[model samples]
Target chain A: MAAEAVLAEAGYAGFTIEQVARRAGAGKPTIYRWWSGKPALLIEIYARQPLDLSGTDTGSLEGDLVAALGRLLAFWRDTPAGEAFTALLVEAQHDHAALEMLRAFLAERSFPLAELFDRAARRGELATDFDLAAGLDLVSGYVWARLLTRRLEDDSRSLSSAARLIARGCLRR
Target chain B: MAAEAVLAEAGYAGFTIEQVARRAGAGKPTIYRWWSGKPALLIEIYARQPLDLSGTDTGSLEGDLVAALGRLLAFWRDTPAGEAFTALLVEAQHDHAALEMLRAFLAERSFPLAELFDRAARRGELATDFDLAAGLDLVSGYVWARLLTRRLEDDSRSLSSAARLIARGCLRR
Candidate 1:
């Protein structure tokens, strides 16, 4: 928890194992023994954080998508943990280990959304041949693009609109 | 040119005015007088390079989008300039001036796509209320997400699929 806080505040450039150990009141050896390094520690911290996807089922595909995306936007806009996760993504570009951990983290995060798609299909809301992976990529991609380009703010209007468009596009005729 | 080459090979971390000066056979003062800093220099180099969008007019929206995105993917995958541009994006996160430059670059790049959307609207292919900005964001966002996450390789299958999907979604029946 202290490490997560430090990561959020310090960013990748400022995050150091020493500071984390000091803040957590743990010995260097204790931290190192349990985790390989910062990437491993960050992954552990990220995995422990709760991602609320239980409310993703809203009966209608459109409602479910908007709610799921709305929650994701809220997490990014409202939480320090979200900032930490972004810092890790940037770090992943140069660090292979971090890239692996980040990929694993992303896959785990996407599972719930995949399940949501499955529910939509079962409800006869989705086309039989719809590409779920591609659809999810578009949904998540729009959010990431805005966030990375600094285009995202407190506004959820665009998020909802994009979700609606995507839902409409992917629905069964 | 030297600065661009240096940026491509050495990346932002290894790039410096000094190295660029030596490579260019120019003095530090000359480089300093013309450009304020690395970010400014990078922006200049990026702007000077040509981005071909002339042939983006393929008549059909799907054809144009696929062509435009295909060119973009080629730039990122095949050119050193693309590598330089990506390094600039990473640098933008830490530098305010760089962020401004990156935003400007992105805006400039989006203009041609906007023109394509205008053509689509004039052709009565798009819904009157279709959000061009949001649509473009989804298109560019998907490409960028894949690029940043290292999930993109030589495959343009997903790009074409997304383009077709977006085109279908935005079209007025």
Candidate 2:
């Protein structure tokens, strides 16, 4: 993880397998043995690698989404992790395997959020007919916007504000 | 545009600029001169591109979002364009120019949607504190879920259902 951090901070142009090996205190050949190259290693590092969603949830659906999304943005804002992942994600847009990996990542996490909406519906917290899928999309869509467009450094307020709107509007149906 | 059509139909490994020129009814040199390469050309096609949202309105917020999303997704499912753009978009994850171009394309479209929500707010249709950002994100996120997950084609009904859900839910507030 530390090695991934260093690489993300430096970028591919400045990346070195030997450095990752050094940072992880592992053998260089060991790193090489598991992966074909830097891109592969980068993808591995990006893989559902643990995101802390502890701060998410605040009683109300909107408040919960706000907390959850804020954590998500914070996860992407890591010094090396965010930038490297962004670049790799851009690269995945072209590479078949990378795109697959990216999809896997989204599927693993995005579904959980969709469930959140579904639960909200069942509880009568939201309209029973509310589209859980759309709710998920709305939240995911905002993240995608930040990643592909602004590439902004996520702050607590931005996530909360976005959550507020989604809660206020999308859940009403 | 034709070049994009061709490339999207064929993977980059199998794609040829000459073929794109022929498909586009333009000469190879002319295409090459403008793009200087394949990646460049791919980005240019989507650059400043627009997703027509004229028919999205359906009186209610959820209805409007569904109609708009349905219209936008129509291109992804029924046309060669979606397949082609996906191929190129997958690649953009790795290529710098591709990332920049796609970001620009997304921003161009997102702004209009954001304004749509704002207009709804002004009309007293939406909660004053609605998350416009989340609304915009949901619109694109559904498409991304399909494209990135490769489920858009296999599950066309899912899109419509999602649309229905959003249409009813988004306007509730």
Candidate 3:
């Protein structure tokens, strides 16, 4: 929580262990005992945020994707999750280690998404030749762009439109 | 050119009029006369880079989208364009004015993309209810995610796959 507070106030440049420790009224060694460093701390803070991906089992992939995007956009817009993730991405741009950590975090987060696609396949909704990774990339990429560009406020019309496109793309003809 | 060379070498933090002038053997005043500051200079240099969207006229929307993405990914991968744009994004993260410029630049860049979609409609390839702006966002967002994550090296297999999904989504059912 102190780390998040510090990150929110000072951004990547000002997010020092000393600052977080100062804010939390805890000793530096105590913070270090829990996490290795800044990137680790950031990840831990971010990972705690709930991404309600439970809607994946919904009847159709298009419905599933739109629901997922709806929850995701709202989560990013209404919570600290968006700020924390944006900080992580900005940090990744400058620090190689942070970039690796961010990539790994993103890859790990894809499991639920992968399941969504797998369920679609089981229902015979997805095209036989669909590349799972590429489809996932487009969906995630769309969300990341909205997050970074601060356009998440546009909401359902745009999202459902996007979902329609992705669904059609991955759908069995 | 000097600005790009400076940016490529030192990145956003070190990109300044003084450095660009020194790199070019020109005076700071001359550089000032040419451009307002770092963000403007970065945009100018980037705008000069050719993004060949002429392939839009290709008969099939899928073919056109694939060719456009192929050229875009290559342009971002092989030239200083990627570095300049990335630096712009990083700068935008920290500076409000830079962020505004980046937003405007991105909006301006969407023209050719709109044309690509409009051409698809003329060809009777796209869905009647398709949202052109949302469709553009997905394609550009996919490319941006690949660039920002340093995954541009994966080449045609991934890009053509992405193109296929986007094209299918927009296709008339």
Candidate 3 residue spans exceeding 4 A from truth: A25-34, B21-34
Give the per-residue lDDT of model 1 (tens digit) for A47-118. 766668796788988789888877776766666555566667677776778888888888887888898888
TM-score of each: 0.89, 0.69, 0.91
Q: lDDT values of the candidates? A: 0.77, 0.63, 0.85
DockQ in order? 0.56, 0.29, 0.65
Give every collision pair in model 1.
Answer: none
Sequence-dependent TM-score of model 3: 0.91
The residue-by-residue lDDT of candidate 3 on A1-173, one tens digit each, is 89988877887568889999999899999989988778888887788788888846679998999888888888888766787787778777668898899899999988988888998999999998999988899999999888877777847888889998999999988
Which candidate tops lDDT? 3
The alpha-carbon RMSD values of the candidates against the true structure, listed in the order shown, are: 2.4, 5.2, 2.3
Task: Indicate which candidate wins on TM-score.
Answer: 3
Write model 1 residue lDDT over B9-63, tens digit each, in one string. 7766678999899989999999999898887787777677677878788888888
- Assess the local accuracy of residue A154 in candidate 2 as a C-alpha lDDT between 0 and 100: 56
